[model samples]
Target: MPIPSTLIGIPASPGRAGGRVVRVAEPPGEPATGPAPADPAGEAARIEPAVELVSTRLTARAATVSGDAREVLEATVTMVGDPALLQNAQELVTERGRPAARAVWEAANGFAATLSSMGGYMAERARDISDVRDRIVAELLGLPAPGVADLDAPAVLVATDLAPADTAGLKPGVALALVTEQGGPTSHTAILARSLGIPAVVGCAGASTLTDGSAVIVDGATGEVGEVATLDEAVEAAAAAAVVTDWDGVGRTADGHVVPLLANVGDGPGAAKGAADGAEGVGLFRTELAFLSAAEEPSESRQREAYVAVLSAFAGKPVTARTLDAGADKPLPFLSLDGEPNPALGVRGLRIARDGSGGDGAGVLDRQLAGLAAAAKETGAELKVMAPMVATAEEARWFVERCRTHGIGRAGVMIEVPAAVLTADEIMREVDFVSVGTNDLAQYLFAADRQSGPLAALNDPWQPALLRLIGMLGEASERTGCPVGVCGEAAADPALASVLVGLGVASLSTGPGARAAVGAAIGGLTLAQCRERAAVARAAADPIDARRAVAALDG
Candidate 1:
């Protein structure tokens, strides 16, 4: 075969996967609503059992996957058993003498259409609802839900897109890669693929057209895909990443400007893994994993043990821990966080601490703080605590004081909210340090939903607008004499990491996978060269132009 044209897409996960394509089959649609069954009761019994089966399937999937994918699957499982949906469908069978299949189909379709019209995140769920309907209908018809699970061979999953539900049962190595015509960095597919360490390229426009069994080289880091025998070898050769040798202590530019490199970890084991990977310290040791998995409110002792384990993982190295950053995506079962029409913008982060209605949420906050203090006392770990979603200096001060009262000597606020970024200088006066969570900052600044595939480009770290904000935060840090850091997914991109360091970010923290890549990238450039790239990038018209400008500087 002639060389295949390369397809560019968003790099949702970093790695390489090479294989033939295995397109997940489309569901057999609304099976013949053929001739109504004489007994509606028998149809109801069959339909209900099918629905239960789908629910059971989803629950099993949820148990298998965690983090974002687990949340989406659990939500789907609930949708399958929705009493309102079941009642409406059963009424058609019992009262209107309609076939159970048609009744369930119409009910699901009606609800799906209503949800689709809502637009934004909810509109995206129409596909999810449709998937649920197909699964139920397929089970009732003695057929299986359309999927690639039965495929014995390992291959790259190529399709228009795999719904969260569709991809839930995907085990690592079952599909060596995942390429789709649509998805964003924050999509469930992207999150799940990354968690599973499956190299993935999402939002590949023509990916669905790739011939089945055609060997392909998928580069997840750069979102490049092609059908060439030597593409993998060529990609590795062309990487041109900075030379990396295992000789690291603290990270510094060639010009010898000290800019500490750190790791963004989610759990205790993650901290140890990051340390083993040569991370000097933890930049973002997320504490939400403990609460999210807890069946009830975790005791102070439990929280302390968890905190101590992570702090000790670094072997007494500095670890910055963010207190319970939960809300929409990370729900606390004990807290009554009401569902929001758009939870991303609504109550989350430090807002939950402020949401301390009746003190249930407040107690969780205090308990967490006390645990950090206990851990610090027990392990002698230099644990720095920070609060998420602090908007004003007052909120910053309030958070600092809360931590201080709990015996935390050092505290800070994440500079994610634009207001906080703009007021970083003042907020820093009330805290010990500042860290920017650029993912959310970019989303809120651009007013684009992070999960929207079309809006994915807007969330690019190279965007001149986002660079300007990082520059502002850097300025704020210097003006206030507070240590400022970038602890976001943006820090994981080596090229972008170089620009971020140039933009005045004092430290960089990234996922464990990128720690060495970023450290190596930073080591190759002189401080002045980074400044040059940053200057060229800041003058660009858009993200693409900014990327080009920076690349030209490297050239």
Candidate 2:
């Protein structure tokens, strides 16, 4: 008997969905044996043509990709064209007398182990190279391209995994839902689906076991994927329901009051869209996007173009652009970063900015500050530059001074570390404003990984301890007469928006689609009511009680 199944995973996209499964399998395996090479040197000579062919093909397709994808491919090209790898392979062939291809394979594996050990951005680059090498080897042995489902029609897509590049061309309207056997909530597929508001489920075991044309129903909100027939009745029952209202502006309460709605954007194009969608301004424009997608440090002109686009998109509205916050987790290949036992706590954010260690080299902060200042001067845009992971007043002052020296008048510090919040007044004295990066702040506060499944219980933003910390920051901001805002996922949550407003957040920034809903929720209450609700929430014993308190306030 075939039991109806309802697999659950992370929701990457959002929408109602009912469709058939389209399974895409992994690439086929390579042959076990091949024609023997004549000699060591001869073997090396024999493989030269194949290496050149792979190199040429990669170079030819280089222009097709842009932004982060382009950077990944470029690094791939570099690894394939690495003279050291080829040299090592040739040496191995001449000394050990191995087949040329086999020698290259062994050499590549050794290089890969070194890369894995190095970690950081180099490790990510190495993985890309390894992937390409595998594909090239397969091609050389006459194997077909990796299995790819023809997404010719709209269906609930199921696969073992998906690459970021594979998701770039996904047809938003047609692709109603997706399920993958493996992927974290923060992976590229999940991020893209969420951005597109498409329903998705990731990390579902046996997700690929579902055959093609097998009917399924995906519930993005709950991360549920079930057989279609099992859900068809429910789908039919809800088919006649009223159209969903647009919830895209400033959140409001029962009674209307104006609340700032903002967007956390990564690039110029995204900023433009967010602004068009009625984002009051950019809450967090991650400058790292400019750096990540480049072979070298982006030229001042290129940086200017990105900055200007974002600033112009918001027009006279304020745009808070955080400087390069790269670290071990999101490293740049060109930057020489040593592997850290605990990277999150190691040299990252302001630590890296101040120390110039971990491959930033001397004058790294100066160049970043100067570029941002120049971009501001050229665009004449209302831009505020902030430093991430600021922990102390001294660090805040150091960053502010650097920005001031570069002619950037407005400087802010991200309140991600506990020390920053604890010393908010001192830090405020050295900067223009403070924006709570609640996600990391909460993670650090609770000693939990926001991305870890086992730590989910500790990751709730509404936890009383986290709320108290936020309240402390709010009180400090009030005492110092400094504007305080929140630019994190918590800022957009409807359930938490009122408490945040009550906590005296001057602005609440989230994704573009969530702006209206948050704005509407905020509009329903006055500052005094929000404060009262926040007090009730703070005084509550647990998240459950706190949520009830928030709900009462909303009611």
Candidate 3:
């Protein structure tokens, strides 16, 4: 008998899932142009309010979601308010005598097409732009915006591509796999799927050809979609593979080198959830969520209340909290930062705190530190405050001094910049601990944008150059007597996590779902084995060879 057809796509998430395919309906086509208004200015006047309404809706959605999904929706909101898009559309309506709907359609599609044509990560953003277009056009047409809701049963979602909004509402475990016709690995669909730990395949041209209700197998790690096994078998295999879940407690290698397993969380609720799932402590507690959710700077009392919740959840356990990491990608109107040609290299993280805020009388950083102090006093949580984007010993000392003044016992700096790594010993003397943010460090180290799927190879955690930098930080920890931890996506990979511990990463913070698997991987190897693998990885030719070297350790 002939084998079933298979479609290959970019693997967005790792895992296998199988079920009957369920196709979501395509977005509605742009409606025919309505009669041109007698007064073009009056038609143009409708633009702002429509944009405002969509912004509010997007903001509402963002509030309900968290993590990458929230970021995607927020980006869409920004696009909806884009001056260029609005100006071009308004010009179409006023000058060309087109109806509001038609003008919006032309403008949004023009913008989206341009981005999609650019290829790579820019093309991936086309979905978000198109999502905004759909919302605005839907509002003008007096119809509900397109989305996927009301799935009757477990399904493998098959579509051309899922918008950020559509993927946000899906309940975990309900969607077996996400297969998209067009999207790269970093697309909203892929990011959301990874967070959910589900199977997903993106950029599959033939994905839309799959029949609704037809049984199909999806290997998300391999980006393969075909009929190889029944859905029941896949579930059974997953259950079998999850055997290591029973092994819990402090992470240790087979030869008993201690490795602390921690969680990366957004808030207290997330921290508590991680703890319940066997997290030893909170490795990364992002404080920006509170600020991102607020219209203005949250009061010290509000920040204190928020901090207390996170601290209380971890209670006596260590919690490494990052102070407000705003600027550039996350701009606060209250913060006075002039536009820069390269915002990535501009006032971001701790640098934002240095800009001298002109809004509130007390500095934003001061308030944040004060809140951390209050939370520490109230909960007696082992809170360790940290700053992002600290590149020098001077900045490290300043942040550490501030933490100490505020009565927080511990402070650290995220050593993601190249300068930080090169001068890590000097910075280590100023701070209590160091955390390596491999994600950004890799991006900046390689000059490869992580957002771009084409540059994904450069950002791979297994890259020898990245491992070498990590090794440098590890050695610095020994020389300076400051513990170093890895609080990045690299810590989530089982094999990579093992290599990380071998390289002298004292702690590993990963998503709660990954903590157990990482711990288990560590438990399976000895410290010497890990060190050997790390050594081999660093000596490897490249990322592919580095990963191969690490994989050989498993054998």
Candidate 4:
């Protein structure tokens, strides 16, 4: 059957492009059964070089990028270089005389299966494992690493999903846009595409049917794709969106209501980029990158250095640091939450440090707070620390006390659970501020996995249920005189930023690439106009209707 003329998908990184489709290279297939190797010792020795090759290649790729792209690549390198995985593969070769490639494949798959079964964020890691497995197997088989090949010219890269290494290697001007058959808004493809300033449309099921070298137009803003005939129109629309008005390092509405625009940063370089991009402050300073690679709990001095880099980058500006949001997708070696089939709903986020979970979570939290306080003292930057997964007033109060005990003045909690929204009044009084983590809130509210492509609509930020939850928290903020900010992927959407303002959110935090667009979007609308649009959105029956209703108002 012929492919459709137009394809609809989730709008990931917003822009538009026209190019011929170029699919990613196929991954290595499983090897057929073969006879046992004659020299097990020699076969085991081959695994080291193959592993080293994958690690070295990924390290080189990682060095070429910075910010989120570099972080994701470094993570892949860590997975590939895990000593336990190499040891396990060697055991298979020595004990059962399995071929080196097959042993590596089996060992990697075993780990991937365990991760996939845990569901949610951890499940995404399973895909990373598959990518690593293929690369290692391809090395053993003397084939090129499986991923995007060298493009002779600019084109729209189509794939089921891109591995971090492949996505990291993409250059802004060469890879015009990205279209994927799977992956939600927060996938590696989407994150890297935004960082690289490339337009992208993901979760397009029809992408697999696109013929190679066929010209097509992709609208990353509207999630629309069409045949070559639409190229001229798409090019014009893209040009208009590309001409973004420069932000002047302030966030305010047309009628002069102030809103703080902040950046979500991962590390020192990311923070520096955010500051350079005219970000007023650091909104979501993810403190997990330093811990992800640690074999044991990072010492206070080590953690202080990590925090100091970001603090120094944005000195005197407010930097809200989230403490150790580990478990689920990011399980630490020192702080184990093993044997949980459903880690997402189980002990994740703030639940990890909750009383009586049979782990040293409290110690972890205390030491992290001490390091953050020390960084704050050294840098003289305004530091506001928050805990993720706080669903009750008790958790809020407990976290605040811990922060105060460590000499951290400002403390807050993330409103990611439904209960957090419903009981916002009590929780607000216990903390200095609250930040709505819309990604997790949408996932839990709709009971859909945030990473699932087919369920992307339900997990969309425009969903009325999610909006209403934010509205509820907004009301609580107003009543208690506590500030509420949004620090999720949703906050990056320009139109949504206005709606959030109308909903009484005090600040909007997003990636560096989005700061200008979001600031300009809010600057054009009055508070009253924003409220009217928010009402129009909340009155709709579904996300599609809500988006259309709000767009109609803009027209």
Name the candidate that leads on lDDT: 4
Q: What tens digits encode model 1's per-residue C-alpha lDDT throughout 1-555?
A: 111448977777766666667787767676556577788888777777888988987898789765445667877887899888888888878777767777888889998877655444455567688778877877766775766566697777888878888676677777778898887766667766765667788888888778777777776666777875543443443333313445375688888998888877776766777777788888988888788757698899998888887888775677899988877545567887776666667677788878754247777889989988888888877889888878899999888888878888889889877888787788889899989988778888899777677888787666788899888887877788898898977787667788988888899987655666677778889998998888888889986577667767756
lDDT tens digits, residue span 1-555, model 4: 111238987778866777778889878889644578899999899999999998998899889888888877887898998888999999999998789999999999999998877776677777788899999999998888789988998888988878878988899778989988888887778877876778888888788887787777777766777766454544554555464665566899989999999999988999898988878898899998788778899999999999999999888989999988877557788876666756778887777888455289888889999999999999988999999988999999999999999999999999999999999999999999999899899999989988777797787788898898898988899999999999988888777788899889999999877778788888888999999988887778987677678778866
RMSD of 2: 5.7
**Higher-lDDT candidate of 2 and 3:** 3
Model 1 residue 291 CA deviation (Å) reads 3.1
Please, what is the TM-score per model?
0.80, 0.74, 0.80, 0.93
Judged by lDDT relative to the true structure, which candidate is superior, 1 or 2? 1
- All candidates: CA RMSD (Å): 4.8, 5.7, 5.1, 2.9
Candidate 1 lDDT score relative to the true structure: 0.77
Tens-place lDDT digits, model 2, residues 208-257:
66788877777654456777554454345324321254554544554554
CA lDDT of 509 in candidate 1? 87
Model 3 Cα shift for residue 16 (angstroms): 2.5
lDDT (Cα, tens digit) per residue for candidate 3, span 287-350: 9888875777899999999999888888888999998876755656667666565666767888
Error of 4 at 227 (Å): 1.7
| Best of the two (2, 3) by TM-score | 3
Ten residues in a row with the worst lDDT in model 1? 234-243
Model 2, residue 532: distance off in Å is 10
> Global CA lDDT of candidate 2, please?
0.69
